[model samples]
Target: MPVSPLLVVTRLLRCLSIGLLLPCVPTGALAQQLASPRDTSFTVHSAYVKAKKQHPDISIARPPVPRGVRAQTKLTYCTPGSRALQLDVFYPKAKRRQQFPAVLLIHGGGWRSGDRSQHVPLAQQLAGRGFVAVTAEYRLSTEAPYPAAVQDLKAAIRWMRANARTYAIDTTRVAVWGFSAGGQLAALIGSTNGNSLFEAGSCHRPHSSAVQAIVDVDGILAFLHPESGEGNDSKSTSAATYWFGSNKLTRPDLWQQASALSYVGAGTPPMLFINSGVDRMHAGRDDMMRQLTALGIYTEVHSFPEAPHPFPLFNPWFQPTLEYTVNFLNKVFPRR
Candidate 1:
């Protein structure tokens, strides 16, 4: 019997897999060859740029609900305009009768784009882990500006508390988790609990906006830091400028006032800071951590070396990121 050409090729591939008649390269050497310094640099630069432009589109379909979880979509939390500001709620169907800790998940788009749907997968995962997780929508820079997004987030927290019994959520055990610009809002919400300046919304006003814990995923801590890579140049229309409606030179006070670090004090909640080690977007994270430490607040910081800014949203990094987040929340807002 004669072998077909396809069979011969398959046999060659099998042999190659076993290192037969092939040069055996060291793992380190092979990695080096596949990713030279120059190539790696370019790849990193490209990834950063791509991540910057990536935002959750309203049209993307939501992921299938996990087997043990139930999702409630588009529940109004606030009404700022013609459209109601809504949130998608996720909770374990099996544990729906029992009270659970709640987490508010905020999506990131430099406060210019992105919607609540971006965090549906995360909310679903948290629900599967026995949490009443909510992914919320807020006014963007396109609709409003600066404090408006923060106001919406704070209002969402208050809404959670206002409807705690309805959602089977433990009012005392709640946290806020956000990515990129959303992270900045989460951090600010965590720090400015009783502060009136940022708490401008009318929804759920009687209820407190405080969170028991905070999870900041690569959010800007201090906008003024040199390492921020968000230059202070007044002429450029950076995201910060767009969000603030002015440059640092023109609105230095607003820039400082908007920073999460500026509000960190005795009442600041425990925080977990996760970052791509190389991202300048999280430039002032260390400073914020130090301030929190000095104030005797519990703080944890984790960085994934050589990862991109949007690392947590994708796989490989997402698994570990989820693990870190769940573990931190479990410790901070433990179920009794």
Candidate 2:
């Protein structure tokens, strides 16, 4: 019996997400090896079903889109030659004359899986609450590696600013929100506001990629910090190792550079950290808060004790997570 290339890639992604490492494959060669039908198994529904094993009462059902909020899906935000990155937007239908603060939401699946639709419910709720919320898609580790996803996000931000009128977005109060791996990305992107290393492509180059605020949900701040649990590739390849294209020991420089804590300093914007009971999930958060506090940059944190890492997508903690996020965003980007 012969194995299908798509099945092989899907299994590889699942292994990587679970911290099992595989041999490094060159990007060009891997691109040529893969066939049609990309894997899309990771989603809020799947996560909820798995989480229900521990929390039997949790729910994944999202509320109805509130009245006056509009949703537009499958909007192309960027074209990186090989692929078209799409995003889903949710914003108020009325009050086109007034520009509202916007937030770009990024989902997480160990950087190997997950897609924009995982955060669509949250975006819809945010829109109902008077925000221009967007859920964006980026190249996963299976498709591309580090800096590629980051670049895609920065491009998405620029796209928002470039089409501010179409979405009724207030460019000055734009924010980036991420869950898990996405949270790590949000922090890094926010920390490196004008740094050119992560900023690439010419899409909406005139519009800045800098975000006014960052919301990190259970995402690590430092990859190689003493408190960090990532890059344990002694026996198996960790997801971080696969995404970075090198183990922490082999490429310490890249790991450190990718850490948000490395660049968080004077210019970093205000931030909010939402976490589950898993301390290892948010490595270096305390150190980051201390630095932000010293710099007089507003910082807030909320932890769901004993909750799973994907608490935001499940009930019992979902409402509170949404509340904290809304409060933090409103406080940082006050409504005019």
Best by TM-score: 2
TM-score, each model?
0.79, 0.90
Q: So what's the TM-score on candidate 2? A: 0.90
Candidate 2 all-Cα RMSD: 4.5
| lDDT by candidate, in order shown | 0.77, 0.87
Candidate 1 Cα errors over 4 Å, as ranges = 1-65, 94-97, 231-236
Question: lDDT by residue for model 1 over 1-336, one digit each (tens)?
Answer: 333557556754664444231222212433233321211222223444575554322122234566878878989999975549899889875444688999999988777766676677778888988899999988776556678899988999899999888778888999999998889889888988888988884788999988999999989888888778664444545767757765676667888888888888898999999998666768778888898899898999888886667776665577678789999999987677
In model 2, which residue pairs have backbone atoms overlapping below 3 Å?
21-237
User: Per-residue error at 304 for model 2, in Å?
Assistant: 0.7
Q: Model 1 residue 145 lDDT?
A: 64
Candidate 1: residue 248 Cα off by (Å): 0.5
